[model samples]
Target: MLEKNHILTPEKWVKLHADYLYNYTISRINNHEISKDLVQETFFAALNAMKNFEGKASERTWLIAILKRKIIDYYRKINSIKGKAEVRMNFYDDGEHAGEWIEERVPSSWVSEVEKDIENRELGNALEKCISALPEKYEIVFRMKTIEELETEEICKELDISSSNLWVIIHRARLQLRKCMEDNWFKK
Candidate 1:
């Protein structure tokens, strides 16, 4: 407690920042088990790489950066395994109209109403729920580029995806979120 320039101990980090990391991760991921695993992995990675930590950033920032990369990797791994299959089944069910929304499922325009509703707490909650309901890759890309306001190039680099792929994922995510909000929030 008295040391002027002392580095943070691992025990101190766990006691202090674990909950913060958990909350930060759960807000993005919406999965308790996976969030916990990522937080733990962040700690392990930070510990192993402590030698390279230059202290330019705060400890929390360093750990959170590692955790963010871990989350991206997790999304990539899951997407690689199940993304193509799910995309085929969900978005390409029609033989000749792959990736186009069906007439019945097309989202109604709510841009003007959305501006007003953005200030509403209930709308915020519904938005969170809708974003959480998106597929993992879409959710990750949507959050990174939209809510997190990361640059498109940064998101592409972090996710190891091309710019066009990022745009397509974001487009699909927005469509799904629009439909979800219509059904859950606007309809009611």
Candidate 2:
């Protein structure tokens, strides 16, 4: 059986997906401890059930799906005491001023220099600091989905979270990152 169907290689794939898992959990939920645990859980789950893995989607995508589910289960298990109803992604209310969101300001003179800095060192350091400052869950989720490029369904499954929760987390993560980048990297 092992020789005839030797498709199980979970370890080889874990590294590829760790960054994805990290970002998804951190960015979406803003919980570092949970995100770290979830990343571990995703790899273990993938390894234990390697034989059952379907090749319909990319390997990363499949892992992400599993991780997302794990996250939801975690939240439900922990928060069940409150008995709150599960809803689709929990969106943040737009600012009370109510005008459509406006584009951020960009400096005409510094674009090229800033781009070079980001490619080299300064920008990277700033980004690292900003990401580290985010709540753990949001950081993980954003990193996974945005930087690592996992699909939403994949993330949801991997984390055991609802689509609604995923969406809300993603939105909030992006908003936070945008603000951070604007303040730290763009303005100064």
Candidate 3:
């Protein structure tokens, strides 16, 4: 008993939805390889669970849903307890607040973990928009040092910049990130 409005068409998945899925993955993951892997994984998972499809959603929408879960799982795997470095260290050493992301400095005493997951999604989108709005260099360095949690020396050497220059760039990037988060996320 399936709905006539929607049907599972697994054979056409690649041609019909590959590009759309890849584009979505790349924008969120920021790593081409990981995004590709997630897209492929989504296809596999959907195939295995195809029997469970109720035809409630179009193939594309259902695929995107699976892809979103895959993306979330990827991030969770990278940010696990063993990946403590993934957490951005606080740059400031003040009397009050010692360390955390520049995004956290915006005073979000309102957002509790007990809140709805939808709120978190909106916040993530806003943060992502702010991050993408950053200047190219800023965005790259910020992701490398903050999001990717690469070592200071590693990032500096890879980017072919002096340690001091890297720090300057990171500081400026954090400042801009804070401002952007405040304006875009907090205001919402």
Best candidate, TM-score-wise? 1
Error of 3 at 187 (Å): 31
Give me the runs in candidate 3 sitting further than 4 Å from their true place: 1-4, 81-188
Question: Residue 161, candidate 3: how far off, in angstroms?
Answer: 33
Compose the digit string of candidate 1's lDDT tens values, residues 81-128. 764534322355657998766667765665455566668998889898
Candidate 2 weakest lDDT stretch, 10 residues:
83-92
Q: Which digits, one per residue and each the tens of the lDDT, describe model 2 over residues 1-188?
A: 43332344565765677887898677656667878998998888888877787665677777887886787777566545442432222232377634444434222233445655656677778887877776555665667787778898977766666889888777767666666777777766
TM-score of structure candidate 2: 0.48
Ranking of all predicted structures according to lDDT, beginning with the best and ending with the worst = 1, 3, 2
TM-score of each: 0.69, 0.48, 0.49
Model-by-model lDDT, in order? Answer: 0.80, 0.68, 0.72
Q: For candidate 1, what is the TM-score?
A: 0.69
lDDT score, candidate 2: 0.68
Between candidates 1 and 2, which one is better according to TM-score? 1
